[model samples]
Target: MAVLNEEQEMLRDMAREWAVNESPVTEFRKVRASGEPEAFNRDAYATMAQMGWAGIIVPEAHGGSDFGYMSAGLVFEELGKTLTASPLLATTIAASAIALGGSEEQKARWLPKLASGEAIATLAVDEGAAHDPAAIETSVSGGKISGKKTFVHEAHGADLFVVAAKDGLYLVENGAGVTLTTRKLTDQRSHADVTFDGAAADKLAGGGDSLLDDVLDRARVLTAAEMLGMAQQVFDVTLEYLKQRVQFNQVLASFQALQHRMADLFADLAQMRSAVEAGLQAVDSGFGVARAATIAKAEANRVLHTISNQGIQLHGGIGMTDEYDVGFYLKRARVLEASWGSSSFLKDRYASLGGY
Candidate 1:
């Protein structure tokens, strides 16, 4: 088992308390009703920024907290529990790209703003149904890029976009030949289908094929951490329901078959936790990050799907209704599973990396 140090534990507790006190289920319900994917509560985001979450992984020289990936993973897990909609993941992933591959000038310009939440950034990598980096259809010519990128998370609100084109990465300023067509995802977050027509872009210096692969591996692991939180939330909610919900003249928790199911779920959740923690450590240690990330994400994807479905099933008809909260977890799980890469995609990645 991976043990968090005192500082990391404090950070995790802080995020948990904030999510409970400020952005509870009631707040999430309100956000969903607003019909805007970028409709995250600004005050909550400000609070997170104040807590240094936005800069958790950024270097201290860049006005960031300079925490490691494990600490960042804890934050992501906490946010996942509430299905909180924010630019946190996008910003973290983009910042990682810059920190790992961006030139000194790029980091000096973008890192501070990202750490301070002054600018929202997102990665635009998917151009089609596949996750092949080499298959990127977007091409750059004369410092301009053109192509359509689909399923760009939080693109509608991002001030900058870290785009992958022609197997190379570049940063394109928002509205620089970039047009966003928003879509309402299952998770209630805003995903955009972005079209670029000769968009002016600044290429990140020294970002080769390996850099993209490295950053993508980090992204996958971070996503798995988030899914772990979601799965745990589902488990908690269902457990609570079982303890109180009565059927056949007794509480549902008294049934043997249902008890066994919950036990099985607990086992699965434990395995997922182990996988996620190992992946986070691997990312931090720079050891088998890609393969570990693939394993973590693939396992998380499977567990989240099972947990969400079971949560709904245990809740009976109320689970399917919009009035209930479990439906939200189900929806969010589906969206998270599809994001970055799907289970099959990650599995293939794991296989390509050789034995698990």
Candidate 2:
């Protein structure tokens, strides 16, 4: 078991308390009623910004807490329990891009805003199908980017877009030929089909074939961390439901078959945690982060998918009903599984890295 330090534990507790008190399931219910792609509570987001949660992974020079990936992952876990819709993941991933590849001036300009939550940015990489960075069909020419990015998360409200075009990675200002067609996804977060028609953009960095690879690898690891949190919550909720849900003149927890199922799920969760932690450590350890990230993501997808379905199954019909919150977990699990890359896609990547 990986132990968190006192400060890390405090941060996790703080995030858990805030998410439970402020952005509870009721808040999510309200957001669902609002018919918005990004279902986050605006006031809650502002509170998080004030608390510096948005900049947890950013450097101190950029108005951030300068916390590392492990610390940021702790906060993400708490946020996952609520399935709170925010741009934290997108912002953190984008910040890494700047930190790793951006010019000094670019970092000085964007990191502060990103860290301050004054700007929302998302990585635009997927053209369509197959999560191949090489399939990036978007083009850049004459300081302009033109292409369509599908399934862009939180893009409906993003102030900036870090686009991966064929010419290079470009940062295009919002509304500079950026047309957003919002998509209503199962998770109800703000996702859109973004079209850039000769959008003026500033080049961030270029010259490396592995730039997109590195970015996507970071995305996979971070996303796996989020999925781990979601799976943990699902397990907790299901366990509680089993204890209270009476059937056959006894609680469901008393059933031997269900007990065995829960045991299996516990093992799966433990394995997932190991995978995620390994990937997190790999990010800074100079290990093959690309391969580690793929394994982490694929394992997370499989475990979370199983956990979500089993949670619903264990909850009986109530799990399928809108009144129950487990359905939301299932929906979010499906979306997260498909995003970044599917389980099969990541598995293939992992095998290829192994020279299979």
Candidate 3:
């Protein structure tokens, strides 16, 4: 586990408590059933905003607490436990782009709103079936962006878009030439496909392609944090069930074979936690961030595959049913496993980062 400061620990505890009491998996089920047309409830998102979660990484000058990436990851870890659907991660990731690539004036104009949750932002980076930042076909001409972006996270009610174009990252406001089409993900969450038909845009003023990579590295780290939380939650539930489930005149947990499997999962979970914490710290410390993020994400995806499957199998058919929340965790894990980068894709990138 990552060692947190007093304030970060407080934030982590607050987020965990909030997810358990206010927005458990059952609450997520209610949101899915209500057909609210948005990915998350507005009231809940507002509550997060009120809690200062929206600006976990933004500098204090810009209405943020100046807490680093690890702090944000702490809260996200809790949110993943409940499968909470909010723009918090998407917005915070977008905020990183502005922090690294936006000019002083741009930061002055946008960071405060993002930190306050008065505006929601998303990074429109994926342009095709493959998740490649270098594969951006989007073009920027005449101060406008024109292309289609798929797999846009937290786009249901986004206020701004930090877009990846052929030239580099650009800022496009929501209106006029921008069109949003919501897609229902397999996880019962909302993702958007955005069409930028000559949407007026301004080029990011600070950094270049490397900055885009930096923003993505941050996203990958946060994604790993969420996956770690998922793996832990499912493992806990499965462990409890095994202890209670009786078969063949003995408790399931007492079976040596099953016990060995869980013991292996526990070991894998520990490794995944180490990778996630390393990624978070590297991002905050600016040391080997790219490598750390890729390794963490790849390891997390592997751990999730093992833990989720073992979870369902150990539950003895009840895990496959909708009445059980473990199934929801599996569904959510599948989506996240593919998001940012899959285990295989990240493995390749990690090697390439080493000039292999």
Candidate 4:
């Protein structure tokens, strides 16, 4: 675990409290039951914005705390524990893009609204089913962007989109020629196939050639933070279940084999946490971000996959039931594993970065 300062500690504790008390897994169940296209409570999002969580990376002049990515990761970790459904992650990633690449005029126009959560934004990078940023075919012509982005997160809820084009990144509002075709996934969250038919686009040209890679690195790291939380929760929940569940007149946790399995999981969880925190810190320090983010997300994909599955197997028949919260974590974990990058994708990226 990262050694947090006083302010970071307070923020993490506050987020933990709110996630546990105000927005538990039951809240996600409510969102699932509502079946709203956005897949989250608007009021809950407003409350999060009011708490200043939406602007963790935005500059202070733009109505944000500018607390950095580490702080943002802390909040995300807590939210992940309870499977909180909100556009906070997508919006923050969009905001980071603008902060990194937008001009003064662009920042003035969008950052404040994004910081205050008055509007929502998300990144649209992949055109195919997999996470391949290099394969983006979206293009901008005559000040308009035209392409189809599949599986756009928070698409229905986005007021703006940081779209990836052949030349560079562009900012397009969710009006005019923009259209959304809903695509339901296992997670049942806000995702869509966004079609931009000659939608007006403003170029984000200031971030240089590496802007997209930088933004994606941030996405990978923050996402890894969330996965870290989920893995931790699954481990904790599974451990508690083992202590209570009895078989053959002995508690499951009392079995030496079961204990050994858990001990291995505990070590894997520790390694995942280390990589994730390093990724977050790298973003803040502006050092080795690509390498760190790759490692972070890869470890996250590896450990969370193991932990969520083990949680199900350890819980026996009850784990697969809808009544149990463990199943929900497993479902959510699968969705997130494919987001930004998968374990295989990250491994390839890591090897490429190392010049292997």
- Using lDDT as the measure, which candidate wins? 4
What lDDT score belongs to each candidate, Candidate 1 first? Answer: 0.88, 0.85, 0.90, 0.95
In candidate 2, position 64 carries an lDDT of 89
Model 4 residue 349 distance off true place after TM-score fit, in angstroms: 0.9
lDDT of 4 by residue, 1-356 (tens): 78999999999999999999999999999999998999999899999999999999999998899999999999999999999999999999999999999999999999999989899999999999899999988888899899999999999999999999999999999999999999998888999999999999999988899999999999999999999999999999999999998899999999999999999999999999999999999999999999999999999999999999999999999999999999999998998999999989999999999998
- Give candidate 4 regions above 4 Å deviation: none
Per-residue lDDT tens digits of candidate 3, residues 55-87? 889989889987999998999999988898888
Order the candidates by lDDT, highest first — what do you get? 4, 3, 1, 2
Question: How high a TM-score does candidate 1 get?
Answer: 0.97
For each candidate, give its TM-score against the true structure.
Answer: 0.97, 0.96, 0.98, 0.99
Candidate 2 error regions (>4 Å): none
Score candidate 1 by lDDT: 0.88
Question: What TM-score would you give candidate 3 relative to the actual structure?
Answer: 0.98
Query: By descending TM-score, how would the candidates be arranged?
Result: 4, 3, 1, 2
lDDT of 2 at 239: 96
Highest TM-score: give the candidate number. 4
Residue 71, model 1: Cα distance from true site in angstroms: 0.3
